[model samples]
Target chain A: MNIYLRLVYRNIRANLDRASLFFELIFPLFFIFVQGFGLNGIVPPFDVGNGRVISYSLFLAAGAVTLTVINGGTNAGTQLWFDRKNGMFEQLLMGPFTRAQYILSIIFATLIIGVAGSLLVFGFAFPVLGASFAPTWEGALLIAGALFLGTMFFGAFAIALSVVLKSSETFQIVSTFAFFIFLFTSSVFFPASAAPSAIQAASLANPLTYTTDIFRAGLFNAVTPTVSLELGVLAIEAVAMFVIAVFAFRRIRV
Target chain B: MLMAPDQVVRVDELSRHFGDKIAVDRVSFDIARSEVFGFLGPNGAGKTTTIKMLTTLLPSTSGRATVLGHDLKTEGRKIRAQIGVVQQQDSFDQGLNVETSMDLYGLIWNVPKAERRRRIDELIGHFEMQEFRKMPTVDLSAGQRRRLQVAREFIHDMDLLFLDEPTVGLDPIVRRSVLDYLKERVRQGLTIFFTTHILEEAEYLCNRIAVINQGRIVQIDTPENLKRRFGSAKAVEFKLLQGTSSEMASALSSSASVSRFGRDEGSGAYRVTTTRPESVIPEIYRLADRLNLTVSSIYISETTLEDAFINLVTEDEKAVANGGRAS
Candidate 1:
């Protein structure tokens, strides 16, 4: 287990150049600002019970943070595809560790990056959008929980697809498809009620929807649907995906 | 004779097949404690496949194997704890600097912070990596990266080590230094299993070698014994005086001293194979003197490992060809 942790640490440290604050965090932060504040004039306001200008910017900010987790997890798994092509995966597989350990290390590193990126986005979003965070410490815990479980679920899914896919190009295609699916189907852009009945049903089935729903609830203390329902859905998805990913990785032929 | 229980590695009929293609066929060998065993073979000869099995990377298709007496299938994690591996390719984390890279590997092995720091410092100097210790691995040269790969494996005192073509693609001086370092570790009781196609490396480093071809072990013996058994005997070649007839070649072939004689098809030169070339040379000179044939040039060829390898492989090929023809 210590070896596995060390491996995770090494991957994060080694990839520092690829982890530029400007590109990954700052750029996404700016995009969230433009989508939130800049679009308020052209885009019509969302109707809430009170006649206050509904800050879609805050909603978009939270969505961006969730998207960052998805991006981080997908990129981490795709990097393994590059390693496999270069024979580095073969080398690691032949080393002392089991395949399960290898996958865990990758997932751990992705989780760190995802959570860190999400937190940074949260810090930037709070000030720019003038959106107040939950005053209670429970909100912070919920945010952390969302990042941790969400990244692991997506990270495991990416790893499973990576082992089955033949090349990075294919992984990229699948990732793009997954991103759009999660982005549109989940509560990233709009509330589940705004979607069609069929779309809402599909969104409820998506693990990302539950994760995003819970995170939004924690940030705004606004419950669109039952908060517990989304949390429960995410928990089951996280556990099931983790098991499948570990098993799929173990059965992979070096 | 009773074998000791402390053998570093024991393989029994280890085979791995990919679908219908048998990549590693029923190959079995063992390494005694502190011995440097060389797995020598040409490309596509199952060296990597066998190494993968030994290192617990791939499951064997049949048979049983163990490392440090722990079953490869059951106790892989424990076996992994007791061994170090240097793969053929450089696999250092490209995102980390050399120091961080080593630190992470040490951390994974659960080394204490103080011990890890001391070992990192010692290894930096020992591997001549002090200058590049702060530089990311992506910035290092091939040789520098290879040094880090080898150094990373030595952070812990492992009982067994696997080096898969560790020195492939390095200059002669660097290759020698790496091999020497491995030998030094072997002297300190580290059992090493390394794969290489360089025969001279096997000759200099290995206590015993297994020559593999087409997924099978063609021969397994000490270098000296293999040289003696399959190595070519001395041979003498002479250019016959212009117009030396085919009849003369036939006559020379029947000589008691000459095992076989043939003429070069293009040059019409006479080549003689003999067990005792020193005595046979005198006989050839005498025959030439009586026949009044002028010898234009004479050359003798010495035996080498390359000759022994070619002879062994060709002998097998010849037997296969003959069987095919008979069938």
Candidate 2:
């Protein structure tokens, strides 16, 4: 078996317990459930200047899944942090592995977590609250594409963050702040347009905004005109982040 | 039957620096097949740093090394695959139990199932860890953890093993047991690179011992050779009662057999270093009688590896201070 796959397996198995369970599964579900259901009861169901009558709960579901993918990135970074802290990082580097192998394994591990976390969101949202995975195979393919590119981008960011960050305390504060900022500035819980004009402008550049829109487009079976541009920007951003992560990973000392 | 180039390890001008601090300074050495090469040094004397370099855990700053016939820089993964390392610090996958940790390590090293099982049982019995093999590493005692850390390396076969202070935190019997096991393995054609500050362990297990101090190799020779060369000056220690022994220290320096000695400030005991303690010891008593000095206690012992280590390091410092001429 490939060592990178073995490492990814180990990372996934070692976590997924209490601490990771909350981040990867429970926290996003809780947020989506309370906010998704709460807003559906409060807000009058309306579309954003479109012919379709979109439910707020379904919109929150899209944001919730994006959050799951983002959490996967954080999980990937924490694996590097834990390995360094517990001496396994040296062991990994000392094995039949280069630094690139270790970092790639984290990227893959986060990709798995992000996909699984999204599945959990979709599974809950569709059955319990009557949401849908895009109606057509083409719609489903777009969701899959967005999930892959989104997870890859943030996963690379997390690993690159791990290599550059000095201490765990600082890493936690900085990554958490980055995660929340990304969440708030984008369309996970609400339309970026619902926020002030400044936040709306910032969301135009936030990669999560496109990812969330892509996800929402799939869930609502309503592909919009901007999906192609969104996919193109995401693909470029994902490649850039992964390239940066590779460079940073190479420079790390055992 | 021996090929001249069958050295399992060869290092030339190998150096490592952390920023401006030189951790390993242009060190060089070789280990032949099945030879136990002991690296002895005080704390922060580059012993662990050297081990880390050879084990491929840390990259060297300059120079070259080859392990199991692979270059250090380009063939690190190959070298790592062929050698086992027991680091100085005891660490484990805290989430795994002792059994799981051992099993996981064996798996990572690609040890096959049947062989891994056999080695695990053999080592667990050898290291006396069966009682708590099911316990998580977080719950093990310091000594128990250390034993597990050492024994875990035996789960896979390798051409060479690097042990950095392997016996530290172990009880006397266990320490000797571990060394004896290492000796037994060396007899079976395994090469061992051991590092320790304990001179006795080096003297016991090493075919050749390198005394290192301050990132430089002070002396590298067989323990017997090092002892024979540096052990010529035996030490005579005597305690004084109701008297300052500073006067006696100066008087003994003139004796032909006594080369040099000093007084222990805390114990008020005078140590006389001499090639012939027979004459120097009696001269001490004679000098004491004339001075009306009351003797509390006195004894003489042969120069040991501990003495050789101290003397070698002291000579190194003096040589450095005197424009490299003091030695």
Q: Estimate each model's TM-score.
A: 0.85, 0.87
For A1-254, candidate 1 gives per-residue lDDT tens digits of 46677667755655445645347677567758776677756666564222223567766677778877787778577657756764557656655577767777888888888888888888877786776544557656667778888998988888888888877788889877987888788877777778899889989788778778678767665554466676777878888988988877776666
Model 2 C-alpha lDDT per residue in residues A119-222, reported as the tens digit of each score: 88778766877653337886788888889889999888888898899987888889999988888999887778788999999898888998888877765666
Error of 1 at B228 (Å): 0.7
By summed lDDT, the worst window of 10 consecutive residues in model 1 chain B runs over B318-327
Candidate 1: tens digits of C-alpha lDDT, residues B174-225: 7787788788888988898988878788788988878877677778888788
- Per-residue alpha-carbon lDDT of candidate 2 for residues B1-327, written as tens digits (9 for 90 to 100): 122477899889899999999999989888999999999887889998898899887889999988888898988888988888887876667777888778777776777778888888999989888899899877998899889988998888788998888888899999999999999999999999998878899999999998888888888999998987876587788887855755676787777787787778887788887778879878988988987887788898877888788888888878878778322
Best by TM-score: 2
lDDT for residue A50 in candidate 2, whole number 0-100: 28
Off by over 4 Å in 2: A15-19, A46-52, A132-134, B1-3, B236-255, B260-272, B276-300, B325-327
TM-score of chain A of each: 0.87, 0.92
